[model samples]
Target: MTTISDGVTVVDHPLVRHKLTLMREKDRSTKSFRQLLNEIGMLLCYEVTRDLPMEMTEIETPLTKSMQPIIAGKKMVFAPILRAGVGFLDGMLELVPAARVAHIGLYRDPNTLQAVEYYFKAPSDIAERMVVVMDPMLATANSAVAAIDRLKERGAKDLRFVCLLAAPEGIERFRGAHPDVRIWTAAIDEKLNEHGYIVPGLGDAGDRMFGTR
Candidate 1:
């Protein structure tokens, strides 16, 4: 794994690499496309949570010996940055079933061409626990940055941004805005196109997943 910044981790797991190859294919159908993204997200979640606090717990076993281990915490929050981010939720929760979730709805202002937050919600323990923000595409970094800004305003401090893919431009912008926030992704593309999409990206993640276009 490569560190984009202090906390941002670029996961290079074999599963992520292999699934990403299929995701990049033009022939991959929407059903397969969505499945691959979730599977990849599940794999990526493993690394992002490596530092999570785990406490030893004791439990009775069916055999003569008695021992068991369970996680300890109020619960981590997975806050998806609307639309596409919601796709990674099930995959992430499959690993951390007890975790809470919050949704932040944002859309670009057509006239100003900037991100605007329309809705947001999080657990009361946000500041005390880790927060993982999800968005499959980090193209220009505008929306990702805006999403974090809103999360912070809502009392989230220990924050991490997780995405299926990112472009260099978006990575730079995200880091510049929130140096303390780490990023996790399956792959980081080279550049953004004139229209703000990552060149050679898996097209629009939301469109591909939902077959909207």
Candidate 2:
């Protein structure tokens, strides 16, 4: 695997670990697992949004009025990598209720090991908004690359990728394919198993999250 380019951020916050611990267990129930994923997603959101633009604004208090500051423009749209990504949307929406939503679906080609897009939908103003792709796992760069490439085609100039877990192999692949994207992952795992699953990973995050197993 290649090395991490300086721009890819890997967050290791306390709350992230706490919630991740809850989700990692085989005993965790579907509801609990899903909730934990949302909690982790919120933390990921905080880290990924650290560089958002802000501007000053006028404010008033019961005792006094003041000119405070707030986010300049919520020119943001959250795009989840389809079904599994949907698991994170609600929790993040709680934080940025006004943000628009988009969805993209990419599946690995069993034979080719490349990402193939099956579906895509985004807000009409996607170009003007900063886009974030949310997924729980990045085992290989294939899916992420394909999804991001589609986003770029639709006019997303500024983009960031947020995920709960990532493998070194996957990150390296992603970095090579996309030098401009800034990746924010909660933890970087050792490597992908022979089947492309992250080692010591929580296991089929989408299935585990929704209790498909």
RMSD of each: 1.8, 2.6
The ten-residue window of minimal lDDT in model 1 covers 63-72
Which sections of candidate 2 miss by over 4 Å? 1-5
Candidate 1 segments exceeding 4 Å error: 64-69, 109-113
lDDT of 1: 0.85
TM-score of each: 0.92, 0.93
State, as a TM-score between 0 and 1, how close model 1 is to the true structure.
0.92
Residue 75 of model 1, lDDT score: 73
73-183: candidate 2 lDDT, tens digit per residue: 756899999768877888888888889999998877777778788889899889999998988898887888889999999999999998888998888888898889989
| Candidate 2 TM-score, C-alpha based | 0.93
Top candidate by TM-score: 2
Per-residue alpha-carbon lDDT of candidate 1 for residues 85-197, written as tens digits (9 for 90 to 100): 88898999999998899898877564655778888888887888789999998887788898888878878888988998888888888889999988898888888877787
